[model samples]
Target: MTTWNLNGMKHHLFFCNGGSCTKKGAEEVVEAMRDEIKLQEADVRIHTTRTRCQGRCEDACVITVYPEGVWYKEVTPEIGRRIVREHLVGGSPVEEHISYTYEDELAARPDTKEGQSKTKRKEAQTK
Candidate 1:
C-alpha cells in the first residue's frame, strides 16, 4: 500500500451525509461531485471526505471546502457539479451557494467587553 500525505492535497472537501443532509439529497450531491471530479481528473489535487452532522440542520446537504474554509449550504447535484468545475478546477468559490466562511465566524465573535454588551443589546432588541 502506498501512503499519502493529506496535507499535500490542494483542496479537501467534506460532504455532510448524516440523516438530515441525506434527506436533502446529500447522497446525490456526493455522487455528482465524485463524477465531476473524476471527469476533470482532479483526484490528485482534491480529496473528498464523508462526514456526519455539521450542526447546520437548516442548511442540510452542506458542502465545506478547505483550506479556504468555505461552507456551502443546500447543495443539489447540479450545484455539486458546478462546485467541482468552477471552484475546484477554476480556483474560484461558488458565491451563491456559500452559507458562511471562516471570516464570518471570526467577525461574529465579540472580542471585547464593549462588543459583547452591544451584541447583547442587539439581541434584546430583536426579542
Candidate 2:
C-alpha cells in the first residue's frame, strides 16, 4: 500500500461506495471527482477515501468533504466535477448539493431529502 503524504491536504473527501450508492453510480462519481481534482489542479490540497455506508443510504452517492464537514447528496458525475472546481478549487461549497454541513454541530440543511426515517436514529440515540 502506498503511504500518502497528507501534510498539505486541506480537504478530505469521503466517497461512499456502499451498496445503495453503488446502485446509484457512486463509482462513476468517484472517478469524475478524482479526474476533476487533477484537471482543476486541486489534487495537492485534497485527499479522497472510499468508505462503506455513511448511514445515509436514502441519499445514495454521498460525498462528504471534511475540515468544513459538508455532506453532499445525490452526486452525479457532473456534480462531482463541480465539487472539485467550485468547492475544492474555488474554496466554496456547492449549495445546491449540500445535504448536511457542520458548523458547531451537524446541521441538516433545508434541502436535505426527507426519506430517512427519524425512528431509526431516535432509537439509536435513545439506546
In order, candidate lDDTs are: 0.81, 0.84
Off by more than 4 A, model 2 = 1-3, 112-127
Model 1 per-residue lDDT at 104:
32
Would you estimate the TM-scores of all the predictions? 0.77, 0.83
Report the lDDT tens digits of candidate 2 across residue range 1-127: 1327888888989999999999999999999999998888778888899999998898888999998988899999999999999898898888888888775345467655543333455666789
Task: Choose the strongest candidate by TM-score.
Answer: 2
Worst 10-residue lDDT window, candidate 1: 106-115
Q: What is the TM-score (0 to 1) of candidate 2? A: 0.83
Of the candidates shown, which would achieve the greatest lDDT relative to the real structure?
A: 2
Candidate 1 lDDT over 44-107, as tens digits, reads 7889889999887788889999888878888999999999999999988887777766653333
What TM-score does prediction 1 earn?
A: 0.77
Model 2 Cα shift for residue 82 (angstroms): 0.4
